[model samples]
Target: MLRVKNPVLPGFHADPSILRVGNEYYIANSTFEWYPGVEIHRSRDMVTWEKVASPLSEKRLLDMDGALASCGIWAPCLSWSDGLFYLIYTNVRSWNAGAWKDTPNYLTTASSIEGPWSDPVYLNSSGFDPSLFHDDDGRKWLVNMEWDWRKTGSHQFSGILLQEYSTEQKALVGPIQKIYPGSEIGMVEGPHLYKKNGWYYIFAAEGGTSYEHAMSVGRSRCLTGPYEFHPHNPLLSSYGHPEIRLQKSGHASWCDTPDGRSYLAFLCGRPLPGTLDCVLGRETSIVELEWRDDWPYLKPAPGEELFPSGAVRNWPADSFEPPVVLDEYRKKGEFPPATKSIEYRFDGSAIHPDFKNLRTERDPEVYSLTSRPGFLSLRGGQSPVSHWGQSLLARRQTDFSFSAETKLEFAPTSFQHLAGLCWRYDETNQYLCALTFDENLGRVLKVLTFVDRQFMHYDPVPVPGDGPVWLGLTVQVDSGRFRYSPDGKTWRILRPVLSAAVLSDEFGGMGFTGAFTGMFCIDTLDYTARAYFESFKYTVL
Candidate 1:
């Protein structure tokens, strides 16, 4: 029996758009602010898959500092035609002239899978979750969220709109028609284009992308249509009550098995409070699909769960297996050390926001800490005074017991050049301890925290230090205690005063960022100021 294992994918992968070329399927998902944008994974037999490459990894493809982590790359769609793969995604840089700021929608293409792909053809279209679909007549169309009433004159969110795209000009070429007003059926954003059984399907998500979200389908005969909503509208259903991983559904991409059976890879939260999901962020999940009486049905095995709980599977077990990498930063006597997760920076390492580690493809050249031969070097600011340059190493803080480490050589002629470790939820809420060596002031250590965008805790009691000192962070979630360590062993209690609660959906739940984890870093520094790291490591002890 060729059984497609249920709950096929796991982890913080979301808004999946899958395309099958021959027996191989290629999938791309939204990669928000976490750089090397738009994670791409490939699969066979519609079950097991592995991440191969990201098309938006370079500076030309994305700009991270331009958008916050949760809002960068949202609901991307992929399609393979001729010998290239066409990708369409959204980046809302700013709306209402920068009031509702984020990335704008974009589109690009690649010939080979792993990329040195071309730059994105920026679109002036006002929307998000961009997807591309080709019609039977060899014409192509683009679908995205268009702020109809909201951008036009309302205070509420908007609906999904469709337009024709020109690959040659890398731009939208026609009048956008509002085919689906989510207000009519609870749909909000993340719309995908699909064709099936001689009819066109606009499979999209509705609601505010939170608890009320769900997948809906609308059909029409022509590209510019008189579309009809599905009678079985809210097709795939899950946790809308009691707040579970099933809360926000929809933003799906269709896939088919070798035997012609169909399935969908879409966004679903984890089990939550367990090994499952909680608002932190929307992850990806795959469900076996069946077209019974010309409608779609989603059924999973008895013990099936969504992502995070969905264990990684190596599909087509005979051909290939996904490689597992153990992050032992200190194992091989690695250089520039490993990044310090959460720690009290002492000596040499100060805070430099220039190194934008969270940056997407837009300015990777500005700041980079790589693992080629093992040493991490923070370059001078891309310019003399560049605050937007971010060059830091970070991990999604998902697990409980862990320690982050870093080796610092603070050669700061001025306090402006710095390196440190942090636990950043947003610009408003973060805890940072840094090491600084000013030319005239010598060396000193400082701890800073922010809550509700207001500064509350500041431990600027200066201490002198020389040589390389290790910075570590130990967090005990059960008791709500976060401690910092100079050496990985002894700990000092530094309290973070809150302007608002850090835990809860209201304060932006730190649930499941795909690359999200409590990480060790060299600090978010600039491309101009130089710093060197001798070692970096993280361990779950």
Candidate 2:
């Protein structure tokens, strides 16, 4: 047996929809408020995974212009049938509108996983987390959790709805039905259907997406019927077990290996020590499943008690061992030295796949790789706090301890034009070490930190000559600081250590995404101000 570590896909990879096609496995996750929506990863042996593609890469496929933080993409479901890959996702237009949630579902299909996915076909706005189920009889159905604003508390989640999808018509037809009203645990969502041995099984996430989150299942003899809840209910959950490293465990998708072994890919969160803040956001973890008496249960390791008395089995962080292992799988190896570091030279025709723009589409007016040939040219648009157009390009902060460095060249005539490296969680919470022109000092570097929407500015440090300056940020767990270098080697601390804890879900009120580190250019005076970034480097410490 090979011990596979938990959180196989770390750093903000949430709402995983796992599927196995032949020998390859693919997991699609939600990219909320980030452009190029869904993030998909590919795996061969279930233990090793790598980012393969982001299907929603064009403006025609996704348009989230003024979407608030964590309000663009939600629970994406990926499936395969009839030689085509089917992807169902929800475009959340409004989530903060008190009692109303304007969630519109859409579907897109492609013959290949890494593909030119077709334009999205509007599905419905009654709910979200929609999934397409291809029945063995050649009929396709869609299942999603219904949302009712009139209802209060958990009742707002309503029930799971089932409807027939006409592939030939490219639309949904026939009458819709409410299959399951959900269990006693409310806030039901992320529905997925599977059939085995004349039994129709429906899996869903319940108890909300917080600490009480869980994975529940129900089964019935018919496709849509009075489903019976699981004998123990919530087949997998980490609730009431704060000792466990993986918290907020729910929103799962299942798949079976070629050897008939069953596994689940679920979203989980890792909170900082002594706090409920998950700076890395919700990640993806895998757990094996066992079927007995036609019901599924989390399979525990030999002599290990799995969810004993509604409590999950605790594993020490130092041990780095999980409670379950995959039999006949190869031993897990350490990540390569090169895998810990990434250096983008900005010489390619397009930005690296690891980098993603905030909210808006990849407009050439805001950013261009060809404008400066060897450098990434960013034309500053709005201020960082604006929800609309902001020239910000960043990547996920995958490690608790890592460093990011970038070289920026910009001639700012006034303080309104700025460009630098940033550690951003959202518009309201971020630390920007920017370069701008001061009245007394020529071009200077200043560190601006925002905590819970409150702003704090540090003293400015003047630059020596008229040349490109190097800016860097290093984070070690809960604390981080900014630095600068003139020759790309010798560096000086630009600001005092600040709390990185603010860049988290708990600290950033109403936030669901994780922290990111990248380069940003802001010009409040005019949208035409340009800044050039020669290179950007990120390394895991």
Candidate 3:
């Protein structure tokens, strides 16, 4: 029997759009502000998953030059019809600027998941989370939220809209119609259309994308009409019920197995108990379901109990398994340093795609492993402020308490040259501990923390070293400490123990992403400054 985990795909993999073509299952996730957007994962047994290829690999499709931390690609909808695969996503310029301002959605297609995807076809600037619905009769439709934030009313989110799409023309046609106004729950988005049992079903995310997040559905006999709301309304949610391990559970898509069994994949998070800090960010989880009287009900895992006393439910163990991680509960002493190596694991490691492949958002050809064997060479490009040229590589922080250290070799000549380890929650909220040349303090090491894009504290210490400096960070739940070691045996404190809770979704106003601790380099003045990283060691304590 295969034991499938709850968070089948973990860490920064959110707003999943799962599709099944034959026996192969393909899942696409939202890569907000990250390059190589729309990360796709493939699986056979529905338990073990592998990253196949990223669809948005070209810079022409996504230009995130100055995009904010959580404002790049929002919800990406992937589907297969006929012989080609279709993908639709939004380029969120800035969430802080305005809700509906300059947010353009686009569509792209490819014959195979791995190869040259067609150039992005502009869909509309109406709103984000766009999806393509191909009817069984060969007709196609596009559905998404109509953002009316400028309107002077409580209902800024203008209901879901639908439009006819011509696959041959590769464009949308006819008048847009407001199909379903949305459920009673506000902040509704992430809509996916499904037809089953001779009824058109609409599934959407509601109550924002936070702890109050939920999934609601409505059905109708026609494609666009006065859809009848399900009496149960939110078919599944963890909102208000704090006891549930899976919080912020919504934005779901349904899929059927080869044998005709039903399953749902959705975005969810597991935060620290009392602090409610989700360092792992929103992840993907699957749950089984059963239909009764034309309505769907979530079938919980074995021994699963809901708050306030709900019916005892269970699913076939071989087909479905609850979210389980190997090291989420291990103590500090349990992880022996000898056994813990930086060899990348898709579920836990910060390295996206794979280890040894360090990448910036949209900047390709910036880092090289062949130039210096066994070491990563990152050239200076733009500072972290710029979304495009920022020469940075980061992996999601999956544990509340963990220790990460890296050795950097760099010789800085000007103040513009900087290289170090960074704990980032976005461009604005981050912490940098690096080695740089200070005119007065020659070879100096410093630690700086930024909150809301402003420097909160800066501490510099004189370190007598020409090269090969070790920078480390130790984060224990709410607090974090920085250290610098001249030799592997001896270390010195670089900064005062500070509050890492600020990186939480609740504290970091720009909080769609969790903290990413990794090495980075910035040549704000020119693209000449270079830094080589020898090794990286990360351990979940």
lDDT values, one for every candidate: 0.56, 0.86, 0.75
Tens-digit lDDT string for candidate 3 (194-279): 99889999999888888878888899999997789877768767776676677888889988877777788998887876767777
Task: List the candidates ranked by lDDT, beginning with the highest.
Answer: 2, 3, 1
Per-residue lDDT of 1-541 in model 1, one digit per residue for the tens? 2333223444356778878887787878766666667778786544456667777766667766656436667677888776788888876454434325444777787888876677878775566777788877777887777654335333334666778877776778878787777536553677777777877778777755555557777777765567677665666545334443344566677866666777677775543344332323465666666575565655434444222245311111111111211244225332221122333222233322212246544332433344222445555442111225455555544433455566565555456655566555555455565665556557555555565456653544343565555555554432133444545567665555322125222354442243222322233343355555655454544
Prediction-by-prediction clash tally = 66, 0, 4
Every model's TM-score: 0.74, 0.95, 0.89
What is residue 392's positional error in candidate 3, in angstroms? 0.9
Overall local distance difference test of candidate 1:
0.56
Q: lDDT per residue, candidate 2, 127-150, as tens digits?
A: 989999999999999999999998
Q: How accurate is candidate 3 locally (lDDT)?
A: 0.75
How far residue 368's Cα lies from its native spot in candidate 3, in Å, is 2.9
Which candidate would rank higher by TM-score, 2 or 3? Answer: 2
Candidate 1 residue-wise lDDT at 493: 56
Candidate 2 residue pairs that clash: none
Clashes of 3: 4
